[model samples]
Target: MYYSREVAHQIEKLRKGFPVISVIGPRQSGKTTFLQHYFKHYSYFNLENPQTRDLIEQDPQQFITLNPKNIIIDEVQRLPDLLSYIQVHVDKQQEMGSIVISGSQNLLISEKISQSLAGRAAYQNIFPFSLSELQMHGLALPGHLDQMLKGFYPAVYTREIEPNEFYNQYIVTYVDRDARLIKNIQNLSQFQKFMRLLAGRVGQIVNISSLANDTGVAPNTAEDWISILEASYIVYRLHPYYKNIGKRLIKSPKVYFYDTGLLCALLNVVEPQELATHFLIGGIFENFIISEFKKELSARGLPVPLYFYRDQQGREIDLIFESKTKLIPVEIKSSSTFNRTFFDAFTYWRKNIQAEISGYVIYSGLDSQKVGEDNLLAWNKLDTLIDHL
Candidate 1:
């Protein structure tokens, strides 16, 4: 079954301008599906097959010669050197949207693309399915716990696989197979522990020393593994907003998993019911909301990136979306009960930043009330604020 992706619109728009479009994201992010669905007329190549990779390695020019002028290359990073040949082929072709390439690793694709196809290609990151995307596919959003347990991965829904079983195999395959493409892990057990440690800290400030201590590895090892994880689309770090240079604030970046279901697996969350009273329920809930906001902005062609705000006094704002002229503050709470206290961070934001600020509170509760400046939103309607911003 083919499902619609919101980011496809942006890819379609970019296709009209760039000669080479590179789609990079985690494995199973539907990069191939999106490209082939939209660009059905182009010739497609899957470099993962041993024979196809061998053929390309044997004679790059010959392989290029036999393929159609417009082509789709999957897992292009498997042959990074072939990008130069792709560049030459793209340079000679005057047509826009002549070639599309998809890769799993950003660290591999971005550097090679910057080197060989700098001005020749436009890159796009394809994360897992979003809430709206799933809804569009005829699957209504389940309760918060179910969402956290099942996650936003397309396969989990489509294949109807058991979340616990799927994630178990996913971790093993990702670590034993995909992770090696970046760096060799001497001890897979330690790597797994490192993941759990990071997962435990989702929606909290990233602390390398403590994480290393907990995982029983050197901080440097943890750092390297974190990089590999980020490049592999397992997790991301949100930088703190420091627009007020003179204000003393916490400089640490908060950690988040790209998919909450994976985080659940790491934390040994076997069932959705466990998530309700789970100690990290707040963190997991915030993770889902923050990632939803991030995806919305990225898919909408927004120029700004996501940031957070905090001061030495321990005051914190969950998310800050900044543009050339505006600062948007979003606060998240996991409690079902709504209170006036949730607005404290936004209140602090309003006072500290002289610029225009839009405020929103995404709470687990369904009830909503308008504070003086902040608009309370049910968790279901997070995209409403995200779309407008």
Candidate 2:
């Protein structure tokens, strides 16, 4: 029941060019399964086992000496210092695709790679299933709300685990285990509270001071929690587009969950029907469309180049794809009915920005049309927007 991942070709290309390839993503994103499936000949080791960890920690050189080539190491962050030994082994061997390292903690893995495996390892991010990936298997749910609730995690489809059940365990494992592994938080309960509060603020600009007050922690503590969330791939920050704008723009980045299904779990939206009347439906939908864009861009091994634009006068565009010669503005709406007013933000931004390539309005509707110079797209036609960009 294994669905093929879209990044396989990109990873293969990287392996041909680098001695080591690091597969990074959130836990349960299927890095281990994918690596095992794709690199069948590569010897595998899971550092999570206490005995295995001790064996390597005791004599990393011996471990390397025994299994120096075509090896896949899972949870490599368990022994960050072991990377130095790996660095030496790869340098000595000068072999392409000799070692593969996988980890859930992006910050630790990336930092260690930069310090120890610099110019030796290439990185490939393996996030949860993207909409396009699911569609290839005919597993994509009927409605957008249902898709958002069920989420794109591999287990939800491959293991047939219920969304609530999987996310409940995911939260507990992440908050209890991964959080402690990354930083020391005396109050785990408070951190959980902070997570729920941040969930409510999705698609909105982060206010660290206010979040701290709501979470009953110091502003610095809240900020640190935010960093931990980002590092863990639980959330991401969408920065605003401020280049060449004459007016004041918002400085704080808007927060979004990497997976909308987890976002629903945090907000207590158990059923798809609940979204129809839910207050956060708009934000949730916005998160879904934006995350899909991210998945599409990542799968193609392209730069995100994605940003949101906001001015002091309250004018804003939901998404802006900035490139060297063009700026693509996109507006997202949850409604099924098309409205001409959706283009107002695009209209306003066009006057000040000279690098305009085009604009788009994506809504939850069946019909797509064109108005003026831009395109209006149905939500399901997101790939078309990606193609245009």
Candidate 3:
């Protein structure tokens, strides 16, 4: 079952103007499936296949000559040099959507694309299913805990794989294969430990030295591992929104997993009900909300202008969505019961900024209403907030 993707429209729009369209995202995020299904008429080729890779390496010109236009290349980063050839052909042919390429290893693909394809290629980031996407298919869960545990990974839906079982294999495959491919790590077990510790600190500021001590690795190694994770789209770092507010602000960034199901797997939370009393439930909930917002922006091919607000005085906001003209402050809470006290942070933030702002408090409660200048939104109605942004 193909749950129609929101990014498909953006990619099609890009195909109309660019010669090469680059689809970049994490492994198993459905890049291959989505491209194959959407561009079915295009000649498909997977460089992962040894036979195809050897033939391309044996005679690059012949490969380009044979499949001159309307080509979809999977895992094109496996042969970065081929992008140069594709660029040459497209430049001379002066054709739109002449070649489409997708890759999971973003660091490699991005570097190669910048060097070879450059302006000729347009990019679409494919993350796991968004809440809106799931809602369209009626696969979205009503409760926050159930949704967090189930996650938004396509395999969890398409293959009907249990969340725990799927993420367990996901971590192993990521550490054993993708992690190594991104950078050489001598100790895979230690890297796995680092990931677990990182997962435990989701939605909190990252301390590389502390993480290194916990994992028994150097701080540099810990930083490098984080980069590898970010490049592979396993995790995302949300930086602090800085302004001269006459108070000291925390500079370090907070890290969150792209998928809550993977976060649950690392934290060893098997059942959705178990999260009811779990110690990390609040952080997990926060991570889920932030990731959903990210997926929403990525689906529309918009820049993620998300940041967290925290200072030395302990004043903080869960998320700060910055646009060119105004900044939107958002606070995330896991409590099902609504409370006016959730607006305390918003009150402090508004006083510091000169701009008049309408704030939002996103909680697990079902009731969504306007409270004075602020909006009390249910977690499921996040799309409403996104739409206004």
Q: What stretches of model 3 exceed 4 Å from their correct place?
A: 244-250
Error of 3 at 86 (Å): 1.5
> Candidate 1: where are CA atoms >4 Å away?
244-250
Error of 3 at 105 (Å): 0.9
Error of 1 at 124 (Å): 0.7
On a 0 to 100 scale, what is the lDDT of residue 192 in model 3? 95
lDDT agreement of model 1 with the native: 0.83
Q: What lDDT score is found at residue 127 in candidate 3?
A: 92
Query: Relative to the true structure, how large is the alpha-carbon lDDT of every model?
Result: 0.83, 0.89, 0.89
Per-residue error for 373 in candidate 2, Å, reads: 1.1
Candidate 2 lDDT for residue 30 = 87
Q: Which pairs of residues collide in candidate 1?
A: none
What's model 3's lDDT at 38? 93
TM-score of 2: 0.96
Pairs of residues clashing in candidate 3 = none
lDDT of 3 by residue, 97-163 (tens): 8788999988989999998888999988999898889998999998888899989889999885788
lDDT of 1 by residue, 1-389 (tens): 88888887888888888988899988887888888888888888899998989989999988877874779989998999999998898788757888888999889889999999998898888888888777677674557778878888778878968877788778888899778888888788889888888898988888889999998888998889999999999998888888664331446688899888889999999876788989999999999998877777677667777888777788888888776768788888998788888887766676777435659989888766677766999887776786675
Superior by lDDT: candidate 1 or candidate 3: 3
